[model samples]
Target: MIRDLLHNKKRLSLPKGTGILFAMMFLMAPVQIVAQDTPRVTSKIDSTHIRIGEQVQFEISVEADTTTLVVFPEGQTFAPLEMVRASDIDTFRNKDRMNLIRTYALTQFDSGHYTLPRQKIIVNNKELYTDSLQVLVNDIAVDTTTQKMYDIKPLAEVSRNYSDWVRYLIWGIVFLAVAGALIYWFFLRKKPLTQEEKEALLPPFDRALLGLKQLEESRYLIQSQYKEYYSELTNIVRAYLEEEVHISAMESTTEELVAKLEMMQQAGKLNLEKDTITNFKSVLQKADLVKFARSRPDTHGAEEDRKVIENVVVRTKEAIPEPTEEELLQREEYIAEMARKKRKKKRITTIIIAAAVLVVALGGAVTYYGFTKVKDTVFGHPTRELLHGEWVNSEYGYPAIVLETPQVLKRTAIELPESLKQVISTNQTFTYGGLLGDFHISASVTTFREGVEFNMEDAIQGSVKTMEQQGAKNIIVKQDEFTTPSGKKGIKVHGSMDITLPGTEKSEKGEYIILNFNEKGAFQQVIIIHRQDDRYAKDIENRIVNSIDFKNQ
Candidate 1:
């Protein structure tokens, strides 16, 4: 029955498009009652005894739900006691009600006993009263002869210095300019080759001939520079073979090239005479010996080998066929396309690297200022939005319990037995949550006979019974004493319960904390229910409980 009521309430309260979730319920009403027990008001002072002119905090707190408006007794209400300053009204929400507290700093000039008359507060257009409180003001004893006096001292000005950030600003601008220039050069700038630069490009055959002519003009052969001569001689022939025959001749050893040429001849791919092949092998083998073993050759032998290499190159070119017009055109087009792709790939790579570096630098700047906000920006929290959203802090129910929450609790109707209702003068129940949310909270304030004290054991027992009625089973309850910041004591019952909703065999895990505070004839109860596994909801729960204020002096 309770579960069904909660579902109905959530269906009406939640926004459109929200799926049916079985987690929230609220009693909706705006009730105003004017019975003798409607609002419980209390006034207390920080100290009953104080020296003359010494200030004391006088606190008046009223507990009721949002259905009623509570106006505190302000102005010079204390005749003998002078009112110094009235504090801003501090409101607390507890479950379905509000606890409104207003404090006044009072001091008296003359030393004497003072009787604070009962203060009247208007609640929902009805007058409610708090009992008169007492305070004592005594004159402080003064011994003029024993007291020492000190002479006044002159004031001196102190120098102050502030750090300059102009240097950092200038450096930042310089860095940005350099980065921009680099990005432009790598990704955007384009420079075409001049006509002179294009003329510098040489065909493979012409380059090889030019290299041989340069080597012959040098004095390497006459100076017994056999190593240099052999190195240059082999390089020119290897370069010519690679470009014309498409062989990796520059990277191959002499023996490997000879074997490869023999295989190509056997495959009828190339026409090479045995003598020419032998001549090529001899030149390469002699070059390796001179370069690695410091072997020297006579000038006559070097000249003869050079002429033999020249003849070999001429014969090889004669054996090679020239490209047709179509093949030449296709080769030029393929080379141009490849060059374009290389440039495009290089530009894309440069942009990606530059953007990555910029993001890293910006992230560092953000992290240096604030870690939490930056962390949230990168990795968001599940409940951060709700925790930081707008909140309401107000008084609710009789014997008002004050609290603050993300949203206002709605008042719900409660049916009580005739006997229990007679003893319970004012009973207000307010609740929040009945949607697909992680937390649920309820607050209730009940007032009994003015002199009767509420029992802690009975309250805990009543709470356990209520949870059982709501489909809780296998309940494990732990009890502890709690004291609010204002020094009011209460009983806290907390633990886990296995709750199965109506008509469901599967049970969901839930945890709850119930705090019950009673003073005079007023009882304030606050209960929070949350998913056991949600640590974020647990943090919120702790924050709510820690903010409890009883308004005690």
Candidate 2:
């Protein structure tokens, strides 16, 4: 030992404080070695014997002490054989030398001489083994003639007692209340038309008066409660719109209510003419700023606004057209027809929906006794007949297919030649921002022959009309034709184009060219014109054209 110690000086001569560490390490060395070597496994049986169709548990475990630990079962056969579960589990060491085992349980229901192999458990630098257990299974035989199972019958639904008077009494109470309301409305219409009624019928100015009086009483203006001022102004406007146009203005947003009013005006139903609504919208928007924006109106602006409101009230009174005989008759007829149709439709729709419900309910009636036919439709036919795979390829437009197959490579790209520079429409730059760009020109145009082969000439019709309506600057197009440098069989396309390049800088639209197609139209083309600069408009057009493909695929 002295000679060995002299040979290996670092072995026993531990430094200061190292003695205690050495003792502890010595005490734990065997445990650490065992932990490093011996792996753990688990085994259990849910039951010894299960019926023929029943399953039995066969579990094996392996400690995950190594980076690549695995277990394999050998030799032992399966019984009651049906694999139900195979799971991996983990474990930890307890205060004592006991190991909390992780486990995997496998089960089967098939019967016969199935044996499980010995399980091999692998841990760090070691392998462990578990002995396999045997299982026996037997099935019980039954005589068809002597054995039978009785099925329980379902409980019948409890019948509702139509003979009960309580339901009738409740219905009677509802009918009576409704009848009372009808009587009140009928009588109320007759005994009205007093000062209140006269005021209600007045030009809606009285409400403004009342609001002004309320404002005066509350002294809100003196208190500089601008929020209240704007709120009242908005309310007054909403009330006015509701009364004038019969719209639910009070409950709507400024945009929603204004949109409705404008729609009514466009339909020629509202009496207010052009500039009237423009002013109305401005006033409302201003009031909104004061209310929600927490802004206070100066005395002049406030007074001017109040006067404007009064002026609007007066102008609206003037704007309210004196009903011509023809107009009055038309309005009355429209109202009467709408009311009559509404009543008739409600009654008929209610009856139709109720009848449809009854028909659906009758589908479950005993008259549906063709269970064998239904079964054949659902399962028998499919089982008896041959089946082909289902194909769903109706709208297989380029939408589903990708331009490129592999992730690394990109799809085809192009930039249009400067010679093709032109604008289709002179106006609505908002709608056509692609006309201005400076970049190399390379283009690839593929017509999606599979989809509706849109005629390029016809496609411009819609755009032309829209721009015309917007009064966008117009440019003349000189017709030109180009035989596509490439095409597919059947019809070779001799395409034509009409260019409308912008004439002035103010008319910055430089590309309004329409590509007219002949008999042969294929995949949508990539018409990437060289952009003057990197622009979104040109990029969009290029993408749209390239996205279409009409290969035989």
Candidate 3:
């Protein structure tokens, strides 16, 4: 090949060292057969240019299977191009064997030539760059022949206000001076002390302030999270209680602690104050009502509870007076008395159990029980002129207050909240039982159909026969003067009830009585299905119930 080229008289010239170095390079270099590489696109521009304030689309495309999808960095964002949309992607394959392609579209408004820099694509496990692609466009062409642009609005009037910077500087200087004085007073004038002394300097009052400061950070109360707010408030007070009262309130239920404190007060032994404990108990009760029963207090109630907690905290911190010398001796005697009372209770309990055991040993006979015993679940007879509170019940569930014909709510003489009363003044007739008392005072207005009178005797008699006739699984009586569903205490009067009239269809049982007051006396009949407890439930029926005088009023 060299001889054939020399015959043609073609000669190449190189500097003396250059030729030797070139030869060396050619000899030492590795030979590579490079295929024409696919275009490595870094970005895709939808349009090269756009009029100012008018948008253009741009897209960035990469031509490799292995390449990072690029996004404009914080400082490198395109001012000319505003992004209308963005897409996220990772691995992609190309249909063409020569190139793998991916792109991001970008738009620019201001007309100019924008060049996307050399793009990187991974090939043969190495990044190779392709020459940048330049996009070219011209600014919007304006016709001078047409009327000159007429709508060029003038600039906004400049604001020529006086500078307040000097006033701000003076104010800042004053603030800095005051701050410096405060710092000096706080640090240099601060008492040098041991750790204990420093803590002591943070007196109880200052500690309380600190606690209040921390509490201010928690906005639970303002946010109406009363449960959490009360919980934290109570915790703080409970810690204080342990500090002041020498009792671990955290370990005790309110009921248990209150009872213990009450006993101390009644005996006049230890000085257990009331105002503080009462306030404490009130808050706890309100909290318990909210937490356990989901009973939300009204705004006033919540405020009152908060006030009570505050009072408890303040009052509890005051030191109690210790016993004088004479009082100490008196307390010793009082302790002896308490011991004697405990012994007495134990002895009484023992005597009763022993007597009962002895009677059982003698084989003493007892009479049959059910007919005479007061039924836990059922109401027996009806009466007129209830002397006090009465109870009403139904078979379905606990006895709620029964009123007659709840349908005509507007015409009712007695005002009652919906929960405690139901109307049962039925069109159907009721059998009568004799009245146990002289007068029947019914706030229950009879909305009976024309033929029906409020017949006490017939209604009671029919009720008994109905029960015997109907094979009822159970029946409940509505009672007043028992605890209510929401734990409010009040008297509730019933209108009518459902009776399983044996063998007959279920009838509206209405043998209700009116006491001079409500049924707190003998006429407070019960349903066989004893269900509800109304206000003051523990009050038992007795012979004295008959003495409750009846007035026609």
- Measured against the true structure, the TM-scores of the candidates, in listed sequence, are 0.48, 0.23, 0.21
Model 1 agreement with the true structure over 1-553: per-residue lDDT tens digits = 5466456765667565342333332233354776444578888888989998899998999988757788887788876688899999998987777889999898887677887778889999989888887888898987868987668764344442212234546777887788878877766687676864543477777777777787889999878889889988998898888887778898999898888878876776667787888998888787898899998878888888887788778777776656789989999999999999999998788778778877877788687956665555446654554465555687777546778776677887789889776667778998888422467888888878565656868877988898888778888999899987667789899999887865769878888899988764578889998777764677678777876754221
Residues 98-158 of candidate 3 have per-residue lDDT tens digits of 3333344445444667665554455555566655556554676889788576776753554
Candidate 1 ranges beyond 4 A from true positions = 1-225, 248-295, 298-322, 325-400, 404-430, 434-437, 447-460, 501-504, 519-521, 536-538, 551-553
In angstroms, give how far residue 199 of model 2 lies from its true place: 4.1
Kindly give the stretch of ten consecutive residues in candidate 2 with the minimal lDDT sum: 424-433
Q: Model 3: how far is 547 from its true place, Å?
A: 99
lDDT of 2 at 47: 63
Candidate 1, residue 344: Cα displacement in angstroms equals 12
Distance (Å) between predicted and true CA of 268, model 1?
Answer: 13
Off by over 4 Å in 3: 1-217, 266-275, 298-300, 322-553
* Model 2 TM-score on a 0 to 1 scale: 0.23
Candidate 1 lDDT score relative to the true structure: 0.77
Best TM-score goes to which candidate? 1
- Against the unseen true structure, what C-alpha lDDT does each candidate score? 0.77, 0.49, 0.45
Query: What's the number of clashes in each of the models?
Result: 25, 53, 75
User: RMSD to the native, candidate 3?
Assistant: 46.6
